[model samples]
Target: MTRFSFNQATANRWPIPDLVAGCVAAGVTRVGLWREQVADFGLEKTAALVKDAGLEVTSLCRGGFFQTPTWYEENSRAIAEAHTLGAPVLVLVSGGLPPGSRDVDAARRHVGEAIGRLVPATVEAGVQLAIEPLHPMFASDRCVVSTLGQALDLAAPYPAEAVGVVVDTYHVWWDDTVWAQIGRAGRERRIACFQAADWITPLPEGVLLGRGLPGAGCVELRRFREAVDAAGYTGPVEVEVFHADLWARPGAEILADTIAAYEAHVA
Candidate 1:
């Protein structure tokens, strides 16, 4: 059973109150919250309301940026926010190459170091840091961790229970080694979260990012599901879409369509 949840960024405009109301109305039991929205609504209040509505806080939206001297405070604050939201998994986008620094490996090391410092705080909060491997296309600016293999490698040094990986089909589907990595993640028990989106046409203004809807693209999701089931991961199949078009529609419409899509394609 793949439970479904929506990423708050999909409805970037709505307040947390409205977002929760919409998701509950649509029968969704979980959501991924962005740091900004959490702050706006105040974490404790938001958490209480979400609990009242019986919503599961799937994971926090993000917690990393391309390595930079100024990011430490920001990242630290994100960890605190994740705790405030009562989310177990904190999704990290291990930022891309910094200016004048073309060394991809160095950039990766920088992220590792940054995360190393935050391990204590995350542990204190009882939250697992989920390193999300963004698509390779965003490697230059968005995230350096672009493959499940690489994400697993980064988490290998830590206790697998505290540090794990998020498998988003939008980013990993194109990789030839994705299936193997999925199996590896399951075998290692590092698959903290699983997300879906479809590859769509007319590449948006930005690079071809997060375009898949379940069953809308060419990726064999059933096979991926098999690997996940084999590995014993029965968590929510979180729907994280950044579609420009989807954002413009009413939250109600988006929720309705998302539920329908999940049943028709991902279920």
Candidate 2:
């Protein structure tokens, strides 16, 4: 459990104060936070809270959506925020197809360009802009980069320190080529952050919050972990399940279960 980190979205309703306290009580040293939630709690204050509690903000949940009009400004701010929070990586959900556009190729090309524009700012902040490829089911509306290989391709042009990719089991488990892609991520030095969440189905329409705890589904959590480890990733493994029912319970209860699942399935 030394490398175990909890992702805040696992308890979307958990207030920042309580989540910090709960992690401290459970001996969880690291956490993955989200932008909206951090903004809600006041960024500077949240930084002080975690610092005071001896908790490390492993990586920020997100900071990319190139399709938006103000993407440059927004991503710049996100990089700054990650620096303030002591998070080394700012995870990027590389956005989805533009409105009324089926031309995925165009959308992906735009994403690459947008990310390149943000690389300089990332370098200045000393934070890695971590590109996360969402499950293909979310391809139409959430993320167009649907594989580790594609993420690595986009990150290739930038220095490894400036750009990297996120390896989240829930998103990449179904792809047969993931093992090879992970090796490429290592060789290219782009494996920035590794997250874990089991894959479950009967996916709610839109499929955003359909994740399960580590051992609750069919995903090969250990295999993904080993692959990323083999790929030269030695960072915190954040458990990030986003399910309505899971979030409804008390934050402490959820953390306890998440810990158990991680030990049983992912450790």
Candidate 3:
């Protein structure tokens, strides 16, 4: 059975308690959270609440935005937070192009260096850093890790138990090399998270974040499933939609609809 989970990014405005409550109420078996919510609610309390509800936290929203100065401190803090939540994987969004740095290659190098420094801490905490490749559209402002291939390349140096890549359909559906990446990840045993969402045309308000449900758009999620399965990954196909319109509806309504959509399309 495909287990369902939602990224806290969907509930952009709701409190952490409310989001966890919503996930439980929605019958979602798993939940993923952002750093802000974790910090605001405090990690121990957040973990207790979710565990008390008997939910599996699929992964923590992130760590890693390789810039300078406080970058190391920030990454270490996120890794520690992941441990507190008991989340097996810590999703990492590599930082964007720094100012006065037209050299994307340089920015990428910085991301690589940062990951190297952070890997030890992640390993010590017994948390896997799941590198989440943002869409190419977000290459400038969000993450330089913009493709599964790129993310995998970064993961190559670390132990699979300590570092892996998050395969989110929303980010890689449009990539010409997705299948190859999936196959490689499965073969390498480096898949830590597998999430899904639809890709619609003309995009949406937060287009970089993704919009719609599985099979609701052009993403070949079944194909993605097939590839992942072939590579020997049987993890939950977490539903991480960031639709503004969906968020406007009641959380329960969204959850019910998401369950239906997962069954109809992803399963």
Candidate 4:
């Protein structure tokens, strides 16, 4: 099997300690974590749990959300948490437009600026700020950054080690320009994290928990993996699924199924 890192959101209800043990049992040495959950579990405790279990926190769940008034402070804490957890990358999910504002361009610009502001902290913490572009379906409510190209554009001004983009199959799979953008990300030395999740339909209420495991939906998982490989991304491939059904299962079972899907599809 390829080196797979299970994103904790796949089994959102799993306690951090249990998730660490589950990864060890599953032979998964890496994981992607969410900030909220990390805080809930106590950052230092979660860090120690993973370290003791010999697991690597591949990337922290998120550091962005430029629209919030407290974004700077929150992201600063996220950077510190990522460092404590030994995660080299901090995923940034640019929040949606300001309340009721339709000027998406302005929001995108603000996200870029916010990221630039965070570069100093990320660089000092030895963490790469990996910007994740959500699907267009979430443009107004989730993230304004909806394309890999746009994500890369935002990261253009920062050093690759300080700011890069996440090449997640779930978000960019529907874009015909994705392959090209992956190549562009590589050329610019800006590809930080590669996340895999299949694009499923029958959207959930918020359209955030409908992602399927690698092989469970219609996305071209192997194609995306191959493209990322071709683009010079020699990094851990993280399986990050967010589905109500998946989360309802036991954590171990969910992780096992996630591994099966990654092997059959992404690996």
TM-score of each: 0.94, 0.98, 0.93, 0.97
Off by over 4 Å in 3: none
Candidate 4 regions exceeding 4 Å error are none
lDDT string for model 3 (150-247, tens) is 99998898789988999988889878998988899998999999987888777766675457877779988878877888999887778878877777
List model 4 lDDT by residue over 131-155, tens digit each: 9999898888779999999999999
- Per-residue lDDT of 19 in model 3: 76
Query: Using alpha carbons, what is the TM-score of model 1?
Result: 0.94
Better of 1 and 4 by TM-score: 4
lDDT of 3: 0.82
lDDT of 1 by residue, 1-267 (tens): 237778887677778889999988777788988888887888789989988998889899788894767688887787787787778898999989998888999999878878778788888888889999988888988899999999998888777768889988778878999888888888888999988777766677765444655766676666666677777789888877777677788888877777777777777
**Models sorted by lDDT, best on top:** 2, 4, 3, 1
Q: Which 10 consecutive residues of model 2 have the lowest summed lDDT?
A: 201-210
Strongest candidate by lDDT: 2
Candidate 4 global Cα RMSD: 1.1
The per-model lDDT (C-alpha) reads: 0.81, 0.92, 0.82, 0.90
Lowest summed lDDT window (length 10), candidate 1 = 207-216
| lDDT for 200 (candidate 1) | 66
Deviation (Å) of 124 in candidate 1:
1.1
Error of 4 at 164 (Å): 0.2
